[model samples]
Target: MLTAFLRVFAGEGHPVVLFLDDLQWSDAPTLELLRRLVTTES
Candidate 1:
């Protein structure tokens, strides 16, 4: 599932921005996944 998103957000040449909202209502696993994504370069 994460792999599929990485491919979609590849951005070919431009840039890709990933935005998330309602963090107060988010679960632990969701937050953990977001943390990994934020730390990754590509």
Candidate 2:
């Protein structure tokens, strides 16, 4: 699900910055998802 979401902006010819608010309150799964998103960029 996260891969599909991030892939949407992978080739849009523009910069995309995701501001994740309240990150400290996020769950482990959510953090893991973000880690995968950042490390798997093409």
Candidate 3:
């Protein structure tokens, strides 16, 4: 699933912006994915 997301973003030609709301209510898996995305992309 994370690979799929990385591919989607990486394949895009234009800049991307992901808007996530109510992070306090986010579940553990979601937060973990976000962390990985940030670390991997940066």
Candidate 4:
């Protein structure tokens, strides 16, 4: 879900401000993917 949002945000050429409500509830892979998204280019 977050990856799709990131991809769409990147494709639209818009900056994103993600406010995760319950980050602790997120799975490890999802968190890891978000980390990669921040470090890597779209």
Candidate 5:
């Protein structure tokens, strides 16, 4: 679900701002993917 949303945001060429309300509650994989997304240069 998140991946699809991100894909659409990227497709639109708009900067995506994700507000993760609670990092502690997030799954490890989701955090990892978010890290990769921000660090990656497309």
Candidate 6:
């Protein structure tokens, strides 16, 4: 699911911008998904 979501922005001519807000209110699963994305992406 994450890979599919990321592929939406792959191989584009324009710049890709992501906006994440209200992380303080995010649930554990949501936060964990973000952690996984950051770790794998880096």
Off by over 4 Å in 1: 1-4, 11-13
- Where is model 5 more than 4 Å wrong at Cα? 1-13
TM, every model: 0.61, 0.66, 0.62, 0.51, 0.53, 0.61
lDDT of each: 0.76, 0.79, 0.73, 0.75, 0.73, 0.73
Q: Which of the numbered candidates is closest to the native, going by highest lDDT?
A: 2
Which residue pairs overlap in candidate 6's backbone? Answer: none
Name the top TM-score candidate. Answer: 2
Instruction: Sum up the clashes in candidate 2.
Output: 0
Give candidate 4 misplaced runs (Cα > 4 Å): 1-13
Candidate 3: pairs in clash? none
Clashes of each: 0, 0, 0, 0, 0, 0
Candidate 3 lDDT tens digits, 1-42: 765656666754754567898999999999988888777742
The stretch of ten residues in a row with the least summed lDDT in candidate 4 is 4-13
lDDT of 4 by residue, 1-42 (tens): 666667775665577777768888999988898798788766
Model 3 spans with C-alpha error above 4 angstroms: 11-13
User: Candidate 5, which ten residues in sequence have the lowest lDDT sum?
Assistant: 4-13
Question: What's the TM for model 6?
Answer: 0.61
In terms of lDDT, the poorest run of 10 residues in model 2 is 6-15
